[model samples]
Target: MRALRYLALAGLLATAGIAVAAPATYQLDPTHTMVLFSWNHFGFSNPSADLNNVQGTLVYDEKDPSKSSVDVTLPLSGLDTFVPKLDEHLKSADFLDATKYPNITFKSTKVSAAGKGKLKVTGDLTVHGVTKPVTLDVTVNKVGDHPMLKVPAVGFDATATLKRSDFGVGAYVPNVSDEIKVRITTEGHAEKK
Candidate 1:
């Protein structure tokens, strides 16, 4: 009957619509994620720093940048200035205050295409128990099924700068660094249901 045929056609159309409208989700792999930074020391030399406790999720719209978003967290206790003593000092109240705020987090409120494969990720950077607005310059490095996990994932390179003093980290002013540089290379792996 024509009624049955119409029902079948409607079902097919609904399935196609769902496929076309579904949003893409990419998960971040903590092992593959890296965050780095460097700051000037007394306006004479620059010292490098890296943090290794990055973990989070990234839901990206491959076909539409407007639908993309990111959530990331970097543990402050993992601060590495390449020196144990300096690292301990960094965790102190004068710096990160890891005891009070163990994590530095980024939760994107908006994402816009920066043209090419780059995107502008605007979010809150919470550090040392203080929160501030920060923007990251990001580039999608890769997107595909992860080889080891067999899950949909996205990789990105992100960079941002912050005024350390603004976060209440004003211990060594005029001698240490004023601006803090943060660089991130991350992979988001989709979570399994």
Candidate 2:
């Protein structure tokens, strides 16, 4: 009976000693990320758009998947529509108004597991001083060691739809595509704790 009790205690200790995997927290490397947008000018014609100088961080737990989230912030002054005159127009009060509102940010409040590396991210997106609830359908591309940086990296693709008009970008809406389709592919590096 004494031997059996000792064995049971040893087994319990072994079970309790099981190690948990480490969580990953990565800082968005803007040079490795792309922020692209496409919209229709008329009914079916496509017009392209892009933004730069995006800065943020993404935190995720691969072992414990529930502990994952993202926070992305982009400068309004970084708005680049390609066309020289159009870029100025976008920064005016009728649109993003770069002078008044310096940054547009998306902060994730919850991350839900959608199965098989897919996640549903719900967050508060603040743009042009208007805050709104936004949901991003996200896919975790991979989490591994990056050969170049010699650091652990996390890759993911995210998509979200925004109504420009709702954010006070109502000018020329019918002419300038009311629905904006955004795609973000980010590769971020995790720092050593």
- The C-alpha TM-scores of every prediction are 0.87, 0.87
Give the 10-residue window scoring lowest on summed lDDT in candidate 1.
19-28
Q: Write the per-residue lDDT of candidate 1 for residues 32-146, one digit (tens) a residue.
A: 7778888888888888878887777777887887787778788986688888998988888777888988998888888898988999989887878778889999988887887
In candidate 1, stretches whose alpha carbon ends up further than 4 angstroms from where it belongs are: 1-18
> How far off is model 1, as Cα RMSD?
2.8
RMSD of each: 2.8, 2.6
Clashing pairs in 2: none
In the range 13-82, model 2's lDDT, one tens digit per residue, is: 9999798776678999888787777777767687766777889988898766668778889986677778
User: Local distance difference test, per candidate?
Assistant: 0.82, 0.85
Q: Candidate 2: which stretches are off by over 4 Å?
A: 1-17
* Cα TM-score of candidate 2: 0.87
Top lDDT model = 2
